[model samples]
Target: MPRTFDGATGPVAGRFAIVVSRYNENVTGKLLQGAIETLTQAGIADDDIDVAWVPGAWEIPLIAQRMAETGHYAAVLNLGAVIRGETTHDEHINRQVSLSLGELSLVTGVPMLFGVLTVNSLEQAIHRSGGNVGNKGMECAEAALQMVRLLAQLPE
Candidate 1:
């Protein structure tokens, strides 16, 4: 069974940042839309949510770290798409970005959620980005909201 957090709730009424990648614009754009929509639906005000664009997946971690360090947001979401090519470059980028983002979340204690999609091709990326498999952005938004609630319960 999948994990759920229906009982989780807290003061996530304002201030969230989303760092999105410019690469794979089409895919990333849809992801952005889904994220924005989910957050809005969850009662996060438009002005309270900040969106930033980066060059690609490799930049997600750095941008997220900066956003988290600012202490201006309850949580940060990292969005990107890394579709595999003939070379292993995609693998390296996917792994590095995911790991770095995870570390950023731990080091900052700011609840950074990874929304990057590491797929085999553009088609696969599209299929997951608000397509057949559902939007990863929506999933990420939910994760960010839940993390914010969880962190709020932590002793600070």
Candidate 2:
């Protein structure tokens, strides 16, 4: 069953750090917009959100990890898009970035939401970024908010 967020007794307002990749500008740009919109809608003040830019997908994890460990933000959002190419390089990057971000979240105990999109082509990435598949950035923002609330309730 799907779990529902109980915002009445948890941390609902806090700082957020978003790390975005500049590689796929078009798709990533749209994703960033979606993420910001979702965060705003969730009652997070604009000034409380911090946005950082990285060169590409592989760099997202490291930046996000640093931000998550800073103890400033309630959560960190990692946004990137890795589209498959003729070479196998895409596979390696996708795996490394995804795994690294997951490990960072576990090690830091901070909610690091994975907003990376691994797709076969730019078109597919676009579709997920803000098209038919729905906006992954918005989804990531929602996940972050929910996680922040949940984490606040955990026994310290």
Candidate 3:
């Protein structure tokens, strides 16, 4: 992220918090790494980024809500993989977590960046996490940086 804004140029301040799901470690691990790298590149130090891992996708929002409400982070980044299977189980988790994260951002007035992948197959998730589709983790970090900067410009 560019530190210099149009007329309000200033140092990008505040820390970031990440909530990662360990259910799909193969994919989520890569996502987590990418997110960390991106945040660092955006001027956030490693020490400033706090990471919390949860059991699975379903558990992401609860922790994310808690983190967002802490008022200690400029943004909360959530990363996970929710792939479709024979049943509609993935659908339920995806809808609830996605909606809840959205609600958390609105209610807490904090930026909740969703890096979760809701895909039809492992291949698609792979493509997104750090594959040809580009890393959603990096994308989420960039988004969080942008939103944090914008929100900082707003009146309290």
TM-score of every model versus the real structure: 0.92, 0.92, 0.92
Clashing pairs in 1: none
RMSD of 3: 3.7
Candidate 1 wrong stretches, greater than 4 Å: 1-11
lDDT per residue as tens, model 1, 82-148: 9999999999998999889889888998888889999998999999899899999999999888888
Q: Per-residue alpha-carbon lDDT of model 2 for 78-102, expressed as tens digits?
A: 8989999999999999899988988
Best by lDDT: 3
How big is the positional error of residue 91 in model 1, measured in Å on the Cα after superposition?
A: 0.9
lDDT at residue 120 of model 3 (Cα atoms) = 98
Name the better of 1 and 3 by lDDT. 3
> What local lDDT does model 2 show for residue 102?
86
**Per-model C-alpha lDDT, please?**
0.89, 0.90, 0.90
Deviation (Å) of 19 in candidate 2: 0.4
Sliding window of 10 residues with minimal summed lDDT for model 1: 2-11
Over 4 Å off, model 3: 1-10
Report residue 121 deviation for candidate 2 (angstroms).
Answer: 1.0
Error of 1 at 38 (Å): 0.4
